[model samples]
Target: MSEHLFSALRRWPDIEAPNLFAVDASDRLILDEAESQLADIQPGELVIMGDNYGALTLGAAALHGCTGIRVFQDSLVGELALASNAGDLADRYRTHTLDRALLADARLVLLQLPRSLAELDEWAQAIARFAAPDVTVIAGGRIKHMTLAMNEVLVRSFDVVNVGRARQKSRTLTAMGARRSLERPRYPATSVLREPEIPVVELAVSAHGGAFAGATLDIGTRFLLTFLPEMKSDAASAIDLGSGTGVLAASLALARPDLHVVAIDQSTAAVASTRETANANGVGARIDAFREDALTERPTASADLIVCNPPFHSGATVHAAVALRMLADARRVLKPGGELWVVFNTYLGYRDYLNRTVGPTRQAGRNSKFTVAVSVRA
Candidate 1:
């Protein structure tokens, strides 16, 4: 039944391609490693983080008849996909933010180790600070993505970090014996931007653990900002699509005090990070940050300007579908003749897609690594 259930899982509402998958070997390995511990756990005591889809949560329920599960997924798409795939078992689990309420007294945790070490540290600290003193964390990832540093991060919070045998190029780390003297986790890390490339004198960026380019400006975004002066001057509204740390959104609000900016991303941390960044930059009133799968919830032909340093990867898979979707959606949401400015890796060659999806695209700027383009909505 577990095999059948895993096989039937789908990555809907997310980019579904032949190479991308809903569940991976790591998900299976984590469940396999936690089988004995799962049997010893009670309903509601089992917590699952970074489940990707419904694999860990539904797997626990289907395999062990566990109920009252508490689950936290960083991505809004992941949450929605889980709901879509959950079917009759949807009532068995509840979604939450990464807080004491989600980790409090959790006896057994199933985690899909995030690629970001900062994010791993945040999760480890939270588990240590709020979960049961004897809670065991069954965390797994692909061997290629996992590092000894991840175990070290867990060790900061857990006294004992046990390495599980590798299976199918995936491994699990069993972390137990939460440290008693844990300090308050410093998440949503804050930093000031003073780089010469950034037009803003001191743009403040606040980022949660999972936000991309946490609390700092990425080079791609920096390149994109160079063309900010050329953006639609008469525009009253703008969107920072896939806004990471709200750098673009905050910058837009600061540059044009009259403009209302909307920052959108799928990650819960990114949305909160964007809001924090806006407030830090004194543009909170002008910037509205929210979580959505791209601009799916946004009304059609509503915005006058949109700026995006679109992500080229979708959950570790280097694919163009995610960026293409964002571009297409930006077109759908832009009023006639509105501008869509984007920065991407030069190697990705997204201009053709921009021309096909958005409108007539033009090269706005380019460096060796990145290219900036502007597309007028047709």
Candidate 2:
């Protein structure tokens, strides 16, 4: 059953690389294992979270005849994949954000483990607070990703926790005895980075659990910010594509009052954090933080400048497809002569692609680890 569904899956619109695959051994193991452990769960009782593509959600609905399954994914790409692949089973499941309504009364939750301990903690906390007292939670991921710290995180939310034996380099962790639900959810933690060591000082960074580097100044972003003074000064508008916590957007607005910045991220938590970071930094009025897929809705040649520190990975796989797509889309959104300022790992060789897709590319700055480039839109 698992093999049948796995073979039918595709990671459309997502980068298809030889090193990256839509389905994996872990996905197969999780579904089969969850089905056996949750054999008696009612159709609506099973909930799926963090499924890459539609494996967990579609598998349960299509193969197990489960109905009314609720699912939540942080990536906009992942959400679209599940919808596109729903086929005739679309009616059996629904997609949601990490919300109280989704988790309320859910008894059996199947999950793909997140890399961030904070993200895992956030999920565990939500399930503990929103799920039924009798709820049983089973989370799975690649063996390399599983850590003793994960078990420790779940123990805070559940009284009963067990780690399953590894199968095909994958494993699942089970939990029960949920801690009492919270009266309200408070997450996407905030931290204030204040130091004379960095140019962007006293900036309050807030990140939703999935946001990269969790509100801290990632080295790549910090490296890019070094070239902020060179950005178009007379520009009326700017965009920060794939803006995680609105770090670049907020910084731009605060640095230049004349520039109205739009910080776009696909994650709801990221949108909230961007707004929070903006508000905290007294630049919220100048920044419009949006939860969106790339800049698909923006008009062509709409911007004076854009900035990005694109992620090279989609989920667990290391690949450049996401960056390539973002760059291509960035070119569509930039006005002729408008520049897309990007800082990436020095080894990625993104300069060649930028020249082909966006326009003439020039290295704005480079350090030991990162290369910042300016790509003008043709």
User: Which candidate gets the maximum TM-score versus the true structure?
Assistant: 1
lDDT of each: 0.89, 0.85
Model 2 segments beyond 4 Å from truth? 36-38, 181-186, 195-201
User: Roughly what TM-score does model 1 have, to 2 decimal places?
Assistant: 0.98
lDDT of 2: 0.85
TM-score against native, each model: 0.98, 0.95
**lDDT value, residue 174 of candidate 2:** 90
For residues 273-345, write the lDDT of model 2, one tens digit per residue: 8999999998888999887777887888889999999989778877777788777787788887798999999
Candidate 1 residue-wise lDDT at 183: 60
Model 1 clash tally? 0
lDDT of candidate 2 at residue 66, scale 0 to 100: 87
